[model samples]
Target: MKYALGPILYYWPKKQVEEFYQLAKASNADVIYMGETVCSKRRMLRNGQWLDLAKEVAQTGKQVVLSTMALIESPSELRNMQALVDNGDFIVEANDFSAIDLAKQAKVPFVCGPSVNIYNGSALKLLVKQGMQRWVMPVELGRDWLIRLLDECSNLGIREQFEVEVFAFGHLPLAYSARCFTAQSEGRTKDECETCCIKYPQGRPIVSQEQQRLFRLNGIQTLSNDCYDLINDQASMGGLVDVLRLSPIGIDTIEHLEAFRQQNDKDRPFPTPDTVNGYWHKLAGIRQSEDEA
Candidate 1:
């Protein structure tokens, strides 16, 4: 299956962001997604800069996709989404329904991001009619759900029309809110507060009262405390999954990408700790199934 490098969800410095993409250029990633899908205030790299980076990355023969914001709170955000849709060089990932509408109006083929609520075969068929070339399945859904959905799509004769991507690795993005949890944790309001999300590159982990890791707060996005891993499950995904997405979390992300690329080696070590494969096994998202363990 093809491997994709997902966009950086954290608010990183411009230099770090550029350096990370440079590493991606040399990695085994077949597809690369870029752009800020979280809060708009994290402008380390503006739309124009992201487009320029996309152009540069496209030269390496890897498919590049621009991702739209998951939550559009204002008209400015909507305008930005329009600009991404209008980008003629590369396809865009529609994270919100507004983005999908913009892409449809622009008559451009788009990929639906995981944030978009496309739960049924009917929704997938409708999106295909609107120029959706591919879709990243929502993280909460498991393998059984996907198999059934693909079967339904096959029966409807729309399964071959679009590709299927799964969020294979990284901390699961659980929810998004109007308020900036990162800023709130620092006793600052969302507006006046400086972009403090950069301080914690991977997000601030929130633990339960029993001292167990619960979730992570990254600006306005809430993510799972444990990284969701599916490298070992690749054998079962041969025919069902088109692409496996690995989200960029740190400098070591490229290493993990290499591991996923060379997953056939039985001696290769699994890199991240406290990983969860339960979501793929149809169990609680945070739990690691014994068989997978």
Candidate 2:
């Protein structure tokens, strides 16, 4: 299966963002997704800069895709989505319904990001008609759900029309809101928050009363406390998934990508801590199955 570097969900400094993509340019990633998928206030790299970066990455023979924001709270954000859809060089990942509409209106092939709720075969078939070339399954759905969906797709004779991608690694994005949780935690309003999400590159962790990590708060997105790891679960995805998406978290992400590329032995022990594979096994998203554990 092809490996895809997903969009950075956290707000990172411009230099760090550029450096990370530099590593990605030389890494084993077959597809690279760039742009802001979270809050719009995190503008360390504007739309023009992201487009430039996409062009640079495309030079390496890797497919580049511009990802749209998951939550569009204003007309300006909608216009930004329109601009991304209008980008003639590369395809765009539509994270919201508005973005999907924009891509459809522009008559360009688009990827349906995980944030878009495409749950059924009918939805997938209709989107194929609208120029959806790829579909990244939602993080909450498990293997069983995918099996059923693909079966339905095969029954409908549209299974070969689009590629299937899964969020294989990184902290699962659970939800998004209008309020910026990072700013709220800093005792500031969303408007005057000063773009403080850049302070926590991996996002601010939220723990329970007993100090157990529960979730991560990144600007407006709520993510799982544990990283969802499926590096060792490739056997389960052999024929089902076309691409495995790995979200960038830190500098070590390049190392993980290399490991994923060279992984031939399925018996190797999982090398990371605070990781969960339960979501792939139809269990609680936060719990790791005994076999995988």
- Candidate closest to the true structure, highest lDDT: 1
lDDT for each residue of candidate 1 in 1-293, tens digit (9 for 90 to 100): 89999999999999999999999998889999999999899888999999999999999999999999999999899989999999998999999999999999999999999998889999999999999999999999988999999999999899999999999999999999999999999999999769988998999998899999989999999999899999878877877899999999898988988888788455554554679889899999988876455
lDDT tens digits by residue: candidate 2, 1-293 = 89999999998889999999999999989999999999877788888999989999999999999999998989988888888889899999999888888888889899999999889999999999999999999999989999999999999999999999999889899999999999999999999989988888999998999999989999899999899988878878877999999999997887897787767356675576778888899998988876555
Over 4 Å off, model 1: 265-272, 291-293
TM-scores, in order shown? 0.97, 0.97
Task: Show the colliding residue pairs in model 1.
Answer: none
What TM-score does candidate 2 reach?
0.97
Candidate 2, run of 10 with poorest lDDT: 263-272
**What are the per-model C-alpha RMSD values against the true structure?**
1.5, 1.3
The 0-to-1 C-alpha lDDT of every candidate, in the order given, reads 0.92, 0.91
Error of 2 at 65 (Å): 0.3
